[model samples]
Target: MTQSTTRTSSVPPLPPPKERRRLREAKAMTEKQVAEALGVTQTTVRSWETGRTSPQGRRREAYARLLETYAAELDEKKHAKRKRRSKNPENAATARPAPETEAASTAAPTPSRKKPLNRRPVRTVQADSRSRQNAQRRKEKAAALAGAAAAEAAKLTPAQAFDELYAYASPALVRQTYLLTGRRTLAQESVERAFHLAWHRWPEVAVDRDPAGWVRGAAYDYATSPWHRFRRAHRHPDPPNGERAGRALRKALLDLPPVYRRTLLLYDGLGLDLPETAAETEATTPAAANRLLHAREAVAERLPDLSDAHVLHERLRELTETVSAPAVASAPAVRVSSERRAKFWTRAAIAVTVLIIGATAFTVVTAPRQYEPTPAPGQRVGGVPAPMGPQKLSRQDLKLRAKLRDVPMNGPERLVPRIP
Candidate 1:
């Protein structure tokens, strides 16, 4: 008997492995289930999904068909769900409402309902009141402690005060100076100079209302002075590393004008108050406030994420900590000896006296000389006899006088003849 001949066509190309995996996951089918259906190990199916090894021959055809079927099934399920929701709108709405109400009721007890329970007992209420009063008493005790600390601080010797301030303030000043100057050595030098000044004036500085502010102001001045510029010109330092966040922040900060940069760093970066920042920058409080606002806008324009005060402050803190100078355990005292101070005053007084004497000498030498004018023949003198009414004229004098008398009167009257 002759059997009917049948032809089998080749399977089309399967979707990419990633696409296959996505389709399988969409239908919530595990690799094991797909593997069991395909009569293969789950590891084989995993390889196929991960694109490590693809199925070959008829297996490839079966895999493609499986993914397609599952994707279609997922779509059908979603469509069926939507259709049911549309057909029984009231039933679906009522079904959701009960669960939502249950959830809300459950969550409400966690916060508001439980709060009333804690508040229900009179004893608890009394305890809370007592706790608040205790907190107030603690605050008063803290204030007293602070006052005693201030008194103790006031009693510290100049050297002790200097050491304390140097330890506490040097790091912050160095960081602030670096931001202002953008040079490590220059920043260090500026801080050193500032502290030196503080050391010399510690007697006064220790008693000042805001010694830190004074030091900060001095550091700023030192950072911005012409001497620093000259030094910077002579020695050009390399920029910060490109990989660090501080590089971008430092560049943005340096782009700002000195006034705005100092105002911003002092106010936000160093945590100085508005008035203190103003004093540091030599600006009025309102002017400093305006500068801070403008500076924030300027920095935000450059680095948008660092616009918030808190964010910028944190960023600056991080950058500063990265480049801060080591704490100085001891610094040389700048206080002049009493003899030296006396000599300085003596020299100053001598200089002043010399200046006064030189000025008097100069005046006497350069002044104009006074001379008395000789009286004319018939003119009167203030302290002398009036010339005798013209002496009798000799013939020769008479002739010369007659010759001069005939000459025209060359005066204002002659130049501008009187109107007739």
Candidate 2:
């Protein structure tokens, strides 16, 4: 018979006993299972089992528990090996005592000393300083922002405060105005005028629950003013029949029978919800308001498309830019001529008084002289006789009278002043 040959596969290296035990325990799996899972030979698994090398890092955890289990099995196998050796008396006797040399007798070679640990104190300090600097910069920036915000808030006046509130409501106002007027110019003018009205009554307006509602009301009234419509109707005067279209637009407005244009402007523009709109428009309710709104819509639809917002914005921005700041507070007041006024009235009064006095004095002077008439000589002597030389008619006067008898009465009439 041929001699049979048996060959054992070589095992891979592993770390010391403690590491092997930890590796097996950490894996929480058996050695055979771990070897099969890793696609390794059983000899390789046993190598890890015998403590010649260790799995590094993350891989160590995967196999720690598994290898530990394998290590326990190895321990049992080692015990069996010792037992067998002890029981085989002939084989044990062959384990003869060794002759001890000094070098051999010396304690088993001590393990190499481990390197000292390196502490990174400078790196730790640098990281701490960087963190503190970042925190300080953030604090300073936050403080500056807070200060700016506070200053801005402090600078706002009551009028500006109200303007901001109105601005918040401007989008709604724009929509409302566009729908109602069908002309951007009209809408913008109406809004500005309305704001002016609101400013005039701001003391009362600001206290209201909704100041925007008041503004809308004012805008409606402004837009629908007969004067406004008339001006728009006659806006163009130079071109041939230029004023006709304007007249027609005005006629349409004036022809609108019952509903006030104000109610229509608010209902159509601003999108004031029914009840609120009614309150602003002074309508009875949503139903009544709708009637006015519908009426305005019918008329507005016939007009040109004048609701381009971009155009409106440009126009408005231009208007704002063109408008000069009022110098009311800074400008000198108009110097009315008080002295001129006073002098005029004074002269008039004096003239009237003098005329009245002259009329009265004339009447007084002329009244007394009228009562006494000169008495004639032959008349009853209620008055003194005329002067003697004039009492009797002279001979020459008689001769003249005889000659006058023949003459015509009108040719030479005698002057008779003697009778009163």
- Among these predictions, the greatest TM-score belongs to 1
Q: Rate the local accuracy (lDDT) of all candidates.
A: 0.71, 0.51
* Best lDDT among the predictions, by candidate number: 1
lDDT of 1 by residue, 107-208 (tens): 774343334321344544576689779989999999999899899987987777776777788877777787787777777777777776676566656655
Give the Å shift of residue 213 in candidate 2: 1.5
lDDT of 2: 0.51
lDDT of 2 by residue, 1-420 (tens): 223222111222334433443455444655566678666765565555432233564346445544545677878877899666544543332233234533443555323212222322354458658977998999999999979966885687656756575666555564455334445566666666566555555565554546676677666666555575467553422222233333433334334542444444333433344544444443335455567656555555654442443332343333223322211110011112223445677899999999999999999888786578788668555677766565678999999888877655562235443355
Error of 2 at 264 (Å): 5.2
